[model samples]
Target: MSTAMSAAWPYPLLADMVLAVHFGVVLFVIGGLVLVFVGNRLATWPWVNALWFRMAHLVAIGVVAAQSWLGMVCPLTTLEAWLREQAGEASHDQSFVAYWLQRLMFFTAPEWVFAVAYTAFGLLVVLAWWRYPPRVARSRG
Candidate 1:
């Protein structure tokens, strides 16, 4: 194919990759808590109680909640939109994958609904932190 077509081809693929990453992050923030609680209960997956893991999980959800409350768009969403536009596609209405994922994660409700939902989820993450307190590594003499 022409150079122009070759150059343009990667944009849609890159956009899809970004969408996949965004989906993974959403899953981590939501599912991480389940792993933490259940793993702790089962006494399996000890790494779930690691301080760093717990803190990172908390921070991820906290950012989402804060962005919603501040009426700000997520950076990942912005990047995906820009990439889709570069690929000559509408940000949210283009590919089947994008359309379905957007429908699953996004809604046309008022801003406060998102803010409240995110805030509630964030609170749950915080509670998980307390419920399964992270373990501190001891120094060996």
Candidate 2:
């Protein structure tokens, strides 16, 4: 939605926007790793190894793993739930931890499973960094 239109909309739309942004984050974390490995294999897709893109992808997953290990709720999830509540929508009946796993991937499991999965994926990202280093972008003066 346009910013002007969104501004005029009611509360529920904010919650929807938050959910969409959260899903985009999830896609980036997953797809970034896929491209890191696959893109390096092909002569194409060199942009995947742009230094800033690699760094952002790594940091993104790193934060996810850290949040899981620390048992902290993601701010996006918190904000979405609060917005939903304000809109008189049912946030969820599940516990805080459960909602974290459920909201993103649509699957439910022990939180430790997500912690381990994120940490393991993070290690893979680090390995990719080591094995296929990102190229620094050059600027034309």
Candidate 3:
């Protein structure tokens, strides 16, 4: 791939629409946690892999958060926008992060809201990490 293409590569897109669906999943998992905290029965289903799923969700969110803070564009975001363009849909040309994330994710949080939310989300991931730590031992075996 050329530099332009490489800059927007979709390791994330190819890896689970990682730019989009993962965001959706993270939101869902977090929302589910809130429900569980509120004593929702759905949060207590026997077949639900809540702990493992939330751990994965939180980790993915952490990676995305780190990338944003470091000023690195997400490959998945690039690829998805490219795919949308190919499909004749609109894409963000250029703008502040606040504008696009708000439009794409339907989030209207203020700048401080985003900062606080990210910090809280990061804390959640840390807590989950303490509880789970990713099960690498089992996976390697």
Q: Please, what is the whole-model Cα lDDT of each candidate in the order they appear?
A: 0.85, 0.83, 0.53
lDDT of 3 by residue, 1-141 (tens): 787557545432343343446466556656744543343345454323355655566766677677656666566566665654543434444334423543656455555566567667777756645643434224355
Candidate 2 per-residue lDDT, tens place, 1-141, comes to 887546545656767777778888999999999998999999599999999999999999999999999999899989878876766666574345435744556557898998999999999999999999999988889
- Clash pairs, candidate 2, are none
Candidate 3: residue 131 Cα off by (Å): 9.1
As for lDDT, the candidate ahead, 2 or 3, is 2
Q: Which portions of model 2 show Cα errors greater than 4 Å?
A: 1-9, 92-104
**Top-down lDDT ranking:** 1, 2, 3
RMSD to truth, every model:
2.1, 6.3, 8.6
> How well does candidate 3 match the true structure in TM-score terms?
0.47
Report the C-alpha lDDT of model 1 over 1-61, residue by residue, as the tens digit: 8877676788888888888889989999989989998999999788899888898998999
TM per candidate: 0.88, 0.82, 0.47
**What is candidate 1's CA lDDT for residue 97?**
84
Q: Model 1 off-target regions past 4 Å? A: 2-4, 91-96, 138-141
